[model samples]
Target: MAHIPAHSDPARQGAPTTSSRYELLTLGDELLLGLTANAHLTWIGAQLGRRGVQLQRNVTVTDEADAIAAQFRESWARADVVITTGGLGPTCDDRTREVLAAVLGQKLVFDPRTEEAIRARFAKFQRVPTANNLKQAYRFERGEVLPNANGTAPGLWVEQEGKLLIMLPGPPNELQPMFTEQVIPRLAARGKLSDQEAYIQIRSIGIGESALETMFECTFSRSPGLGIAFCAHQGQVDCRISSPDGRYGMEKLRAIASECAALLGDNLLCFGHDSIAQVVADQLKQQGRTLAVAEASTGGMLANAFADLCGACKFFQGGIVSTSNEAKMLMLECPECLLKQHGAVSPECAVAMASGVAEKLGADYGLAITGFSGPCTGGGENPLGSIYIGLHSPHGDWAKQLTYPGPRAAVKQRAINDAIDWLRREVLKETHRIAAPQVN
Candidate 1:
């Protein structure tokens, strides 16, 4: 927690302003129905945050002309700047240009440059331009065309009555670079922001939102300009802080976060963006430590997840898919006596499996995941989705039991997420944990 800074004093607000905050409207039915993810929003947010411009609000609508027009009109009143994505194409469904022109009370005018660019792009693709494609040249009065190097839908930047409207293609590849190179510089030139800011994100595991919130109550609201927000998903929490006018606010936030984390302690996970496995791998790479894994119900999923991350080969010693009791005995040297006595899903088997992999692979650290992912299971005490994760380090060996409710795939996914989360928490520095307020 740190002192969150207030918006500069109103008296000081009269000073030079660098940028005007805008409302973002993303238009498309695919977004609402989850057919297409709204990655454009995330990309723009990150890009703008880097430039000290805060996107105040976001609204999403389908490509219907009336609906789009209504939202644009409403947003215009509240926001001096509005950016619309999608519905700028030539298809009949792409009515963004028409709706926006209507909202501005202007007639659609054709631009020669836009038409030429569309023609040239089509020529590059070796296709004849249809009459429908001519719609790409449409523009409103005093509107400027934003060339799309990646696509035919050139973006539009229009100015009217001291308000600015920008329309960009919906595809992320086109939208991101165009905004950065063309739009961001223009907005920066307008002087909406006073100073730049620095941000650091801390990734944590084994901590729930409420617990983190309650513990950091004292420090949470302490800063005037600094901010700390907890973004939680799939049992992992990201604590992020951003501040303008330098690191004073950032440092304070980090200090308070550290203290609160120290109180809450280990299993808090990594402090930065890297995962537990990543942190471990980095440490292993630096210290020359090797690793291995023996998995059962997880079916080598953990190893697969690690593989997705780059630089894994530097420290990942190997992994064993010991799905069957026979594989466990033959590959990892898990004794039959242990399996029969304690069973596959038991803590004893998990520990033995980790140790077996470590010794068999001759690695410094060994990890094992043994669980019952099933519709039914043999163990009378253990039902479906009963899991145990094992960790074997030079110091000692440990195992934890986790019972989650879900279908087979969901349970497995949760197990893997939890496993990675726990690993991250264990390796990171201990910090006080914040516990959020409880509801009755």
Candidate 2:
């Protein structure tokens, strides 16, 4: 796999010959102190990347003119383009106008056209313009003014000594539209558009990142253009494959995804960003089946996944949280003898709970999660992180024992995820065997 480092990537390189090289600098005190997130950087980077202008660095500076000037100068010398957001408003701390003028060695001049536009904008709103609003009309003589249709502050586009600089408004409503309509056309005219790179993420559950790396180690080396990365969260692994060909090189991307899926087999959850619940929801929708859940140590976590989904009432019948042995017997109709012989967290009790819930709710399928998610053990053959997930269907009822070492929150989540994935797999398997959605 070709994993291009940022320093070596042509898009990030500062070579004068590299057409798409760009750096982003955002100016604001709000961003510096985490008062607000720097949304401009993310939006600009994504937009520019699609147009072949890849951002090498993203910098945030306070509303000080010196700080803005220093970053602008650095980007001017180092990169082909520099795009900045914020510090262009009509406030005392809004210093981008003067900073740009200083950086370009030009005097700030009040433009008649800009003033006319700003005054016209205020006039339309039936509001008198403040003296500070006229400050928005000032522009450095070296740059082109891109009018903001949504606000008073106009965006600036500057080209000097082979370096490109653009200053957009701080507000997203104004900046986003201006950048897309006004700035992108200008950027496109500068040079050849960048060759697109594509990314495909195959998410899986019940798998470790390290184990996946080892499994795909040989494939990564053999696949010339495919770039593989594994990110582990909760109990799921997000295996991302990027290709130099826009969107993982099309056919190659699909082939690589298929190969990876085969490697992961039953563990593979689904493609793209769909969560386990979504995968199960889709499968249930296709199968035309209803599901009910009973959760013990997981509380209503297992049921909540389905509940949160849109139109969950169609397929999700009901749920019960049998946290205590008494509740397990009373609510879920779990046998007293079963709870006495095996604790609530045991496989036998888990299976009974699952089957019992299915019978109670009159649903086609039932899912149950029982676990010891805690710092202390809950008196069982299992330890602190041991869990038993049960699935009940007309054809079969079974339970599996799983153990994970983590804090209480993590163990509960993992156990719930295990139950969901197992049900999804079973549903998919049934789909393959029959034409219509059938249980057993």
Candidate 3:
């Protein structure tokens, strides 16, 4: 529960003197005009953070050369490292290389090696390089070239007056690998990276970020050098507990993680980056059980969630998307009486669908979802965002009604998450009970 300083806080900025402070400058009119999201910020920040490098500030500028130069100058003066993405393509609007060269007080020099590499790459694809594509062969004087294995534009690594500037391509496919292979190793060799921090992430469902924060504050004592951060998705929250202080060892962090796991108990989905579906798949495999799913409004999303996991065929039986009442009755063997009386989106119909699918597929468990995720809803009783999740396990069969306020896609995703979490919790309980010693 220790207070963690925000990234923008001047105090935190001043305190990270040992860690190399990096700033990102994203170029492109698409980003500035909101035509494209600046995804580089998140990806680069995460990569750097994992390596214990602090990415301080991010600035986005249009394709204008002056604006790019101005932002680069400002970022270079403030941060020890400045990384730019975009504007490295073959088009005339791609102005990152020239602008950065001018700002860094270096001339743009064409390298025959780079032009040969580009032409070779084009020849490999049975194509010829265009005149503008050769523009990517230009390098800043006294700068080292970072070869791009994925694209035509080779990245640049330049240093002027002790500050480093790394320019990468805009496409994620090209930028990510180059940064990982080229940028990180160079930084590490130069002793510019800090020691990796110790951290644990606990993903949870059926809990709001605020509520989790309050619970942690009330139950857990504030310990020195411990920091907590929460990231909330549509239906889940990831709680990250870190020991940012280099002096603290993993033992303390593990102890705190254990306490947190015990506190969260049923609400906790899984640790680290494991998805809920993956956890459920593991549980089913451990229990030697199989599952089938029936979906109405969520289409095949609920089924895809499980089927997407590796080796899912061992535990995932099959899925049916029963969009129509007739399909529900014919395919899932849902009773006509239940659908007629309580409507298709009701708990009764949902439960019937679950039971029918389990019986039809001869699986150990059945999960079903019928929802009104839409801009339109059934007139009187059932409104938009109304959802019913049904689960049929070897132990019991039940259904729950949930309401999520959002657009169609958001509502569908939330409903799918809820259904998956419900199934996960039920399977978890069954597994625990089976593992427990019998009380004769």
Candidate 4:
């Protein structure tokens, strides 16, 4: 067995200030072949970042025994902690366990406790365990088993000398909970975790990445120990500001955040991980208002965005996917004359649909989307990717037209984001008005 000592400092005590280097090895033919995304890398990286540790590298390999063993040895030699996901099932392609055991010169010991747990889990489904299922019950000769409440494949935790290896199942549901509950606590208890970095995320809409970068560059050009990164999505951008050194503190980060917020202005959605839909929902709930949506070219995606949030039922009354002209006229009571005169993709139709749905559903706010997200145009003056968003609120009715250049799916996503941002701004206006002091 190749023994590698864990990295340690004799002069340090109680949670060291230095961050632990974590390397992740994801094993699956699907990932290496690009048939499946390596979501584990992103998710694990984020979790470790929250704990003030950074994932240094992530290597994805096929389900080959030699390849798996080689990568494990390489990662173990480099990182203080190494974690692997996938290839832990009962199938023939599952090679992580046997490969790692051979590499570590440890025997594969059959654990009766693990077998019993696996049997109990199978019994719950009223199914008998197959012979091959016993493969999961085997553990390392000198290691502890990490129980999996959600699956039959129990995880493994093995250590030699000072280095550690943690193996988890591939299914996200199984992996997420085990990593959170079992892996994190073990690492923390060993004084491997630290809170030495400060991070803040600011989400914004209706802004280009280059524009945001240019705006922030001149202001913070001389600021030392400050780092800014931008992640752009379909219609949103996330600005992450970090100070890796603990000496900077959150006060400096907050002060910098306030400056960024001032520059963002109305373009800023909110801080942290709150999405635009969540922010809109929060505002509506605060105002005791309900919203109904009528979507055309965007289908029901706008509604799905809101419905995905927790407690959406409180503010999201309902939504209608009025794709065809007849459906709009029948379900939302959109004026037939408006559709005929202005066509389905028009500001007139959008406004009518918004007002109609709000009246039909008895909601405080109504949002409508009418667009031509197409390879073909609307067969008139209207070109492809023309979107009209309409809003009918207690205050009044309003509409705006936007042109996006992209494929059908891209246009639809952009339109959905535009509608969400529009509603967010309108709700903010109302919130500000209500909070404003009287001048009497």
TM-score on alpha carbons, each prediction: 0.72, 0.61, 0.86, 0.90
Off by over 4 Å in 2: 1-197, 217-222, 245-248, 435-440
User: Residue 75 error for model 4, in Å?
Assistant: 1.1
Q: Give the TM-score of candidate 3.
A: 0.86
Candidate 2 global TM-score: 0.61
Q: lDDT per residue, candidate 2, 1-440, as tens digits?
A: 11121222433311122345678888899898998998888788777654445578998988887888888888788887778888888889998888788878988778899999998999998988899999999887877899989999999988888777888999999999998898878876776343343355678877788998888777777776565678788789988676544433345555677777888877878776667898888788877898999988887888899999998988999899988899999988898998888778789988998999999998989999888888777564688898999999867999999998878988988888778888988887787678666669
- After superposing candidate 4, which stretches have Cα over 4 Å from the reference? 1-18, 194-197, 375-377
Lowest lDDT block of 10, candidate 1: 8-17
Model-by-model lDDT, in order? 0.76, 0.80, 0.84, 0.84
Against the true structure, whose lDDT is highest?
A: 4
Candidate 1 — which residues are off by over 4 angstroms?
1-19, 106-131, 137-141, 180-182, 192-203, 219-231, 238-251, 267-305, 310-370, 373-379, 392-398, 407-410, 425-440
Residues 61-119 of candidate 4: C-alpha lDDT, one tens digit per residue? 98999899889889888898999999889999999999998988999999999999999
Ranking by TM-score: 4, 3, 1, 2
- What candidate 3 gets wrong by more than 4 Å, as runs, is 1-18, 120-126, 193-195, 218-222, 243-247, 307-314, 329-331, 335-338, 356-363
lDDT of 3 by residue, 98-136 (tens): 888877778988999999999999999999998999999
Give, for candidate 3, the lowest lDDT window spanning 10 residues.
1-10
